[model samples]
Target: MALEGLRQRLTDLPQGRFGVAVSGGSDSMALLHVAAETLAPARLCAVTVDHRLRPEAADEAQMVARFAEGLGVSHDVLSWADGPFARETSGNLSERAREARYRLMADWARERGVVGVLLGHTADDVAETFVMRLGRRAGLKGLAAMAPVTHFHGVPFHRPALDERRAALRGHLSGAGLHWIEDPSNRDPRYDRTRARDALRHLSAAGLDPDDIAAAATHLRAAEIGLQHLLSDWATRHARTHRGANLIDAPALFDLPSDPALRVLGGALRHVTGVAHPPRAADLSRLLAALRSGDTRATLHGCLVTRDRTGIAVLREPAMAEASVPVPLGATWDDRWIVIGPGESGMSVKAVGAAGLSQLGNWREAGLPRAQAMSGPGVWRGETLIAAPELLPDGPFASKFARDDFPAWLASH
Candidate 1:
C-alpha cells in the first residue's frame, strides 16, 4: 500500500517525457527508477547538477550519472564553476542548493525538448518545509510547502512524488536494488532544514502522522492558488502598464479585500520586476509599508515603484554607460543613452550600444562633455559625463541627466 500509492498516482497522470533530478540520494533514485519503469526509457532523463561547492561534489554527481546509466536512462552531470555564493536566504544552504539544482535541471530538460522536470520531494519533506516556514512567520503562501506543478523560468516543474511517504520511496529504492550517495551536508546542523527535519522526525514519533501535516499543506495551497487566481484577474482589470512601468490606482486597490489586495499588488510587482522578496514576515511588512505610504516613488530590488497623485508606476532603474565596452552585447551589458543640452529646451536623448570612440564623434560635435568611463557602475551628468553617478535620482528626467548625458541630436531625429 505504501510505494504502490505513488506508482498508482503517477500512472494516473498524463504520460510525457519525464525526468528525475537524481541527487545521488534515496528519494531521487527511487523517483528515477519509478519514472524509468513507468515511462519509456527513451523518454526519461536523469540530470545531476554538480554545484562544485563541496570538494566531493563532482564525484557525487558522477555517482548519480552512473546510477542513471545503469538504469538504462539518459544521464547528465552539469557543473557550476561560480564558487559558493555567500548567501543567506530565508532558507539555508541546502534549500538554496535545491533551488539552484531544480532550476538547472529544468533548463536542461527544456533545452532537450522535454515537457516536464521532476523532483523527489516526499511527504515528510513537505511537512518539514511547512513547519519551518510556519515558524519563520510565513503567511498562507509560504505555509503551502510546494506546488505539484509550476513553471520555473519557462520550464514546467513537477513534484508528483511529494505526496508519497519517504519510507515508500526508500522501500522502492530498496526493492529496485538501487543505491545512492549520502550528502554529508544533510547532517550538518549549520542548516535550518536539518534542524527542522529532525524536529519533524521527533514529532512523527510523538503521534504526528505525516498525512495530517500534508493535508494541512494541501488546504493551504488551495487557498493560495485561489488567491493567486483572483489576484491575477484583479491586476488585469485595474492595473495599467505604460512605458515599461506599471500603474494601479490607490483608490481602486483599496476597494479589494486586504489579503487579496496585497496578493494582487505583490503579484503585479513580481510580474514587472522578475526578482521578488522571499516570503518572510519582515519582507511582508516592508512591502505593506510601501503600499500604504504617500511616497510617490520607492525602489525595491532595483525596480522603482512610485505612488503619485495618479497611481503607482514601477520602472526599472536606468543605467548610464559604464566603461567603454563593445556595444550591443545583450547578455554582456546593456547599452546606454544620453541627453546633452539645456534642460529648459526640453532635450531628451536615446541611443543604442556603446560603440567605439568614433561613434561618439557626433555627440562630441554636439558639444557635450563625456565622462571618463569605468565598467560596472558609471554615469553622466548633464552635458558633461559626471565623474560621479547618482546612486538614486530624484526624478526620471534628472536621472537621465545623471546618466551618460549625450547630445539629444540622435533623440531629436
Candidate 2:
C-alpha cells in the first residue's frame, strides 16, 4: 500500500489544530509521521497516555515525545491514575483501562482547544474485534467495524487508517528508518485481544483474511445504520418522557421483532440510566422475556422497569439515587438531572425519600409513579426539603433532564 492516499485524506481534514493519540506503537508512530508530513507541525499535536500499567510505559512515552520533537511537533504525556480501576486487581482491566484512557484524552483535547483527535486503528483491529465479538455471539452493532469518525466522552475522534493494515504501517516506519515500541502485552495470552490476533492466523489460513473480514464488518456497519433509522422512527411514534422516565407504548413495542424491540428497550435503559452501553445480552434477553410474560416490574442497570397505562416505563431506580451529592447550581447531578436555583453553599441534591415525599402532599397529583417520583431530584438543606420541582410547580428551584429527549438520545447513542 502507498501513503499517497492517506496523505490526501489527512490534507483534506478541516483546517485547525488536531490532536493525535500515539502509544509508541508502529501504527501510531507511522500516523504521526504522515500527519506531520501533510500538515504544519504547529497544527499537529501529539498526545501519549501513560496508563502506568507496565514499567517501561513512562520511558516509552518519553521516546514518543522526543520523536515528536524531532518532527517539530509538540507532545504531552498524560498519566492515568485514581480511576475506578486504579486499585482493583481484577475484573475487565482492559475495558477499564480503555475507558479511562479515552476520558483522559478527551479532557486533554478539550483543554488544549484541539478540533479532534486522530487515532491509529487499522484494519487488523477491526478483524480482531470481530473475531472476539463472534466468540460472544454479538449482534450487528457489536460485530460492525469501528467508524472512521466517532465521538467518545463528548470528544470527536478520527481514525484515518481503518482501511490500512498493521504490517504496512510497520513497513512504512522501517523504510523511514524509524522504530516503535513493542509492548510485551501484545503477546500476552491473558488478554482477549492477543488470542484474537492468534485466531486471525488460523482464520487467514482458512481463506478469510483480515481485509475480507473487515469488508464484511463494513457491510454490517451499513446494516446497523439502517436499523438506527428504524429505531429513531419507532421512538418518535411510541415513546414519551415523563419527568426522567421513558414511557414506551407497550403494544407497539411488543409488536416489534425481537431485534428492534431489544434495541428500543436497550436504548431506553441507557437513556434512563445514562450508561454508555446497554445491559449484557443475556440479562437484557431475560428482562425482555419477563416483560413480555407479564411480569409487572424488574430492575437492571440501575433502572426500574414497570408496566403502566401508558405502556412500559423505564426510570432510575430509587436505590441508584441513594448516594446523592451536593448539587452544583448549574451543573448536572447523577448524570440525569440539573437543578437551577440559588447556589447556597451547603445545599445538596438527594432523592425525595418517603419522609421528603410526605412533605410533598401533591406528589400523587403530579401523575408519576411513586417510585419514580421518589427518585426525583430534590433540593435539600440538611434534611430540610427545600423544593421538589417535579412535584411543586412554584418553587425557588427548577429541575430538568440534563440529557437529550428520549428519541434524540436513542438516535445519538
Pick the TM-score winner: 2
* lDDT, candidate 1, 1-413, per-residue tens: 45666677667666677767777888888888887777678878888888868888888888777877877998888765443662433545655665666556655785677777877888888888888887888778888768777655445677888778877787777776767777887898876778888888788899987678988998988877776666655665677654234567787777877766666556544444333233344564576567677764555544456676777655544332322232211111222222222233222222222432232344344222232121122232234332122222232332222221111111110
User: What TM-score against the true fold does each predicted structure earn?
Assistant: 0.73, 0.83
Q: Name the TM-score of candidate 2.
A: 0.83
Count clashes in each candidate, considering only residues at least 3 apart in sequence or on different chains: 5, 0
Q: How does model 1 fare in lDDT?
A: 0.59
What tens digits encode model 2's per-residue C-alpha lDDT throughout 164-239? 8999888899998999999899999987899999999998999989999999999999888888877887799899
Where is the poorest 10-residue window by lDDT in model 1? 404-413
Best-fitting candidate, scored by lDDT: 2
